[model samples]
Target: MGSEAKGLALSAVDPRAAAAGLTPGLPLAEARGQVPGLVSLQADPAGDRAALTRLASWCGRYSPWTAPDGEHDQEGAAGAMIDASGCAHLFGGEAAMLADLVARLERLGFTARAAMAETPGAAWAVARFATTAATPWRIVPPGALRRALAPLPPAALRIGAAEAETLHRLGLRSIGELETIPTAALAARLGRGVARRLDQALGRLEDPIDPLRHRTPLEVRRGFGEPIGRREDLAAAIESLAAALCRRLEESGEGARRLMLVLHRVDGTLQEVTLGTSRATRDPAHLKRLFAERLDGLDPGFGVEIMTLAARAAESLTARQTGFMRERDRTVDLSGLPELVDRLESRLGAGMVTRPRACESYLPERAVAAAPPFVTAYPAAFAKGPPRPLRLLDRPQPIEATALLPDYPPVQYRWRRLLHRVSKADGPERIAPEWWREIAAGATARDYFRIESEEGRRSWLFRAQGRWYLHGAFA
Candidate 1:
């Protein structure tokens, strides 16, 4: 029953409930009175829809074009549509694939019912309303939709409850009853929706199902006559596939950002692994090394027969030449950094390593930002200003100090209950506050000094107004 036991109705029922003379949409209280041990659970439409989507994704092993069948009604459960047109032969034949699909689903604890026809509408109708309890699957041969749908009810034409009731009152109960009527007259009397659905089922009109995922354009595959199980053989095959993919990318002047490896087992199972790069790349050797880190986790279940490599994401790339000797000597070459990042991410994870970037800000902490280590066109250069410390405190630590009058540097200070006497000191370098338009308070100037203590340690100190604070320390 529902939370407050208020107007509770049956959303669905199992075969046991049907055996006990109880149907869906009946009052829960009345059902309990009729059947002594009736069990009722609240409706979960969203959860059912999510499960349908997951089922659709899992069905991709059979065919890439798969979609969820319609939304679940109060009494009906949801289903998935798999367009196994050109893919059924891979698993022996259409009949074999259908039996395999149903058997696997049954093993997974789903009382699944499936059907296949030349038209989507006919398949949907036959799966739901035509098949009996003993015969759960119905396969209509090509050009047989007309004969297959003749015995089903008018509701199998995808009509609503009100439209089905209207048809029943007019004595047009079965789909065969409408076959003799003229199309225009039938549409004019019952409705256009009924005529449209009927035409689609009988192969007179087109009704296509949209797949949840689009096939990647940059994909290459190879099917072997015999299944391969050895790791060495798999590695060689991967190297060849990567080389071929890189050649294709080179021809198009593009580099891959993400690559997916799909292995089709001889038993019709699929295993997939994805690799990502920090930057666009077309190098076959580098791509192979990235996959090497994760090769141990990939299981060749029952031996793999068909292997495919697809570049899921890519970007245009341009060729470049090395700089002159003098220019190269002055700059550190970072060409190997991207490969290192790919290796680290392959072992640890993506986004686990980051570098600080320079933002256009005057505030010391805000000036540098940490970001994922994606390759940029230009490298960040050190800003031309007062020398920054090796490490900066989270916030400036307040200290007690005395200094000469005016803008002189401090000679002695006490920080964290420790006294330090200055032996050598630099001049006070004035630093102005951030712009007035920044909407920040304490827009006062600071006098910074580089001081050396008697123990020979260097520290960065700044004075705002009459108070001194230790901001950072030198290495």
Candidate 2:
């Protein structure tokens, strides 16, 4: 029950209360008159939000991307949104997934109505408004979002109660009728929200789901009956911890990317060992092997009483189907690369291994960047552009050059107090500074040229503000 301007009102009602013609926002006195023995409790909005958040977190079993539905209606009913893309196949199919989800929720004493569609908005509409007693779950097939959402009322679009009332007064009761009217006309009559919501429901506009943040890291701990100080015992403990953690990760459809092993020593001190993988993985044996390398120099320090292995960072990693025959397998298994990188990092140090990653930038220096080994970089996009030098200088060196006209390739340039005459030169390739970046006071466009010295050493030279600089050398 909630307080209203007049008196106490029903904030929400159970199925029995709803069936007895009692609705939310109805006066408690009138609701009691309609249904004599009405049981009503004071509403707790904060608690409801917290409960919904917990429910959303629990939904991580279905999909890693899950969030409590931010939109609420007059009835004060709460819901959760799950982005089950690429996850449905795990539970058989979309229909099976929905059935499983609803069945699990029902087992937990929740009356859930689930619907799947091309978009979250459509799913929300269909799940709340279109679902029936016969079918508590519905799946709007791909490319049928418009038809599925057409029959829903304007209120189903998640518009404000007043806005929905206005749409109803204007004889636009259904979403189909609202869609028939021009967006601009509807916006003029109602507001831009109606059009925007309509577009989102129909998949015309993208509606992104903001997943709930995990407050605590997924971890498993073990308390030894006797404090273990020996290296072999510690290794065995880690192996067990890794297996248990991997089991939890598999159950949640997640893989650990970074892990932290916390050791509570008997001397009231703590020892920590952190391990990071190049990619997400849940293989217990691989985790044990990786941890083995880091365990060499670990000091048990008077014996460890408790050991906790926590997955500091994790990501969704679905099950993969392996081919029966290696010869017939068309896909390459590059899983060994991450294992190698993890091994190297364990021996050397974190960030010791790196790979060149192509970046979206026009500046030669910013075009390529050092990234983690597993980060995939696409260099094919740069293939269409002029070839970049194999070796680029850390910083462009200032040089003296003699050229003709306002924009021309240098005829000769002096670098490091040595003069080199240009034998053959390519025309200047003009490159403008990125406008989106902060421009310095004297920053100007660069005109680059591929020039070869008479002695046969080719260098990349660029002229900015009529000053020449050697940027890179070509092999």
TM-scores for every candidate against the unseen true structure? 0.75, 0.51
Per-model tally of clashing residue pairs: 0, 0
RMSD of each: 5.1, 15.8
lDDT of each: 0.79, 0.83
90: Cα error in model 1, Å: 2.2
In model 2, pairs of residues that clash are none
lDDT of 1 by residue, 80-176 (tens): 8888878888877888878877876776678878898999888888988877657778799987788889988888877787888888898886899
RMSD of 2: 15.8
Q: How much is the lDDT of residue 253 in candidate 2?
A: 88
Lowest summed lDDT window (length 10), candidate 1: 319-328
Q: Highest TM-score, which number?
A: 1
The positional error of residue 323 in candidate 2, measured at the CA in angstroms, is 46
Candidate 1 Cα outliers beyond 4 Å, as residue runs: 1-6, 70-74, 133-135, 176-210, 217-255, 260-274, 282-285, 295-310, 320-337, 352-357, 370-376, 379-383, 393-409, 413-418, 424-448, 463-470
